[model samples]
Target: MHLYGCPMTRSTRVAWVLEEAGLDYHYTVIDLKSGEGFKPPFINLNPSGKVPALVDGDLILTESAAIGIYIADKVPAAGLIPAVGTSERALHDQWCFFASSELEQPLWLMAKHTFAFPPDQRCPAVLPSAEWEFKRQLKVLAQGLGDKTFILGEQFTVADVLLSHILTWATRGLKMDLGDEKLEAYRQRTQARPALAKAREREAHEAALKAQAQ
Candidate 1:
């Protein structure tokens, strides 16, 4: 299997899931900044030219949330997601969609205005409202995580892997106040996982590779 993504992006979540699943796969970096992501067959792999596209034999997949769930199913022992056909599975699906649609959507908007587009093309004023939307949705997540180590109580499922990357990125981008204690603590706990640590190390190494080419 192979994963195509750059370092430290949301792709990190997919990498974390792959690591947690104990899967051996190759990581092919796509240098988005230099436009390598928009070139050649990478565009064929994903029309949006997004990172974290997974290739498993004949199977190819994209979307961070989709990749997270796929990895969970691939390695059931990891318990990254609840088994299908149960109440927990339904809740798992709910949280995954919430993270993507409710939480991540605003972050993407803010990201574009803050950094993605050229400075002249960007809307400086959008940051505040975008951040506001991000915070508003995060409040629901904070409430759900109250006194729990992860989204699904004690267990760290695919939901945590899916959303933690967003929460961590939001922390850096908005420098928004992390108001909820349990949610903040939960973020810290999951990030301290060996799989996450290893993912960071690997990502750092990948970054160095990209830098060396420059």
Candidate 2:
């Protein structure tokens, strides 16, 4: 298996999932800021020119959440997710979609206006609305996470892998205050997991590679 990744991209989510599954995969550093993502080879791997593209034999998977789900399903022994036909699995899908669509959507908007876009293209007026939307969605997420060790109760599923990272992105990337104590504790607990640590180790290595390329 080969994972084409870039530091601090959504690829970190796939790397975390792989660590939890104990999967041995080659990590290829693709420099997103250097315009390598738009070049032919990387573009062939993912037409969208995105990081976190996974290549396993003939199968090539793009999109960070899809890659997480694929890796979790691949290693059922890791128990990273519920069985395919179960109601719990349906909930897993629900949380994943909620995190991506509801929680992550505002963060993306904020990023686009904050720093991602070129200065001329950025819309400073959009930031306040984005912040308000993020806080509203965060409250919904906090309610969903009430009194649970993990998203599906006790077990740490891929849902947690996806959702926890989004929470981190909101708090760290967007610098939002996670107001609820439970939500803050949940982020700490999930981030302190050994698998996530291993993923960060790999990410540090990728960052070094990126630096060398520059």
Candidate 3:
């Protein structure tokens, strides 16, 4: 197994899952700043020109959420995901979709307008609306979480990984308010996992190695 990723991107979610599952996989740091994503080799892997693409034998998977789900399913003993056809699995899917579509959407918008877009195309006026939407979504997430330790209440599933990653991005990356104490504590708890730390360390180490080689 091999993963194409960049530091501080959604690829960390996949790396976290892989570490949690104790899976052996190779990591390749895509130099996004150098536009390697748009070039031939990496572009052939993911035409969308994104990081967090996984290649396992004949299977090539993109999308951080999908790749995380696939990795969890592959190692059932890790119990990172609930069994299919169960209510827990349904709810897991729900939070994953919510994270990607609802919660993460506003953050992505803010990112595009703030840095991803060229200066001439950026709209600073849109930032306020994006922040507003993010706070609104935080309320939904807080209510869904309630007093549960994890999303499914006890088990640490990939849904937690997905939601927590978004929460971390909001607070640490965007400096946006989580809007709820419960959400903040939840983010802290999830991010404190050893697997997540290892994943981050590995990415940083690989990135430094690439820099030295250049």
Candidate 4:
């Protein structure tokens, strides 16, 4: 398996899952900042010109959450996801959707308004409303999390990966306070996982190599 990613992007989530599952995969840094993502091969892999595209033999997967789910399913023994058709799996799906659609939306919007969009395209006026939306969604997340060690009880599933990743992006990348103890604790605990640490190190190493080659 091979992963095309940029350091500190959504690709980190998939890399974390692969590391957790102890999968052997090659990592390629797609220099999106240099317009490499929009060029030939990378553009062919993902027309959207985004990072975090996975190539496993004949199957090419895009979307970080989908790639994480595929990796988790490939290694069931890792217990990164619940059994299909089970209620636990349904809840896992719920959390994944919640993280991507609800929790992550505001953060992404904030990023766009802050720096992702060109100066003329950015709207600073929307930032306050986006922050409000993020806080509202965060309250919902806290309710859903309740008092579980992981999103699905004691088991650490891909759902936790998605949730924790988004939470980390919110707190660290966006510099927004979690505003709830449970959510903040959850972020710290999940991020401290050895697999995540290894994933971060791997991405950093690959990024450095890419920089030298350039």
Model 4, 1-214: lDDT tens per residue?
9999998899999999999999999999999888899999899999999989999999999999999999999999999999999999999999898989999999999999999888999999999999999999999989988998998889999999999999999888888899999989989999999999999999999999988987
Model 2 lDDT per residue over 1-214, tens place: 8999987779889999999999999998888877898898999999888898999999999988888999999999999999999999999999999988988888899898888789999998998998899889889988888999998899998889888898898889777898889998999899899998898899888678768887
* 10 residues in a row with least lDDT, candidate 1: 172-181
* Candidate 1 segments whose C-alpha is farther than 4 A from its true place: 210-214
List clash counts for every candidate, in order.
1, 0, 0, 0
Clashing residue pairs, backbone N/CA/C < 3 A, model 1: 80-158
Of models 1 and 4, which has the larger TM-score? 4
> In order, what lDDT does every prediction score?
0.85, 0.89, 0.95, 0.94
Between candidates 2 and 4, the TM-score winner: 4
RMSD (Cα, Å) for all candidates, in order, is: 1.5, 1.3, 0.7, 0.7
Candidate 2: worst 10 consecutive residues by lDDT? 205-214
Q: 1-214, model 3: which lDDT tens digit per residue?
A: 8999999999999999999999999999999988999998999999989998999999999999999999999999999999999989999999999999999999999999999989999999999999999899898998999999998899998999999999999889988778788989999999999999999999999999999999
lDDT of 1 by residue, 1-214 (tens): 8888888788899889988988888887898988987888898888888898998888889888998899899889988888999999998999999999998988888888888888898998887888788888878998777777688887888899877887887786657666777667777788889999888788788778878987
Return the lDDT, model 4, position 25: 94
Model 3, 65: alpha-carbon shift in Å?
A: 0.4
Q: Report how far residue 133 has shifted in candidate 3, in Å.
A: 0.8
Stretches of candidate 2 off by over 4 Å are 209-214
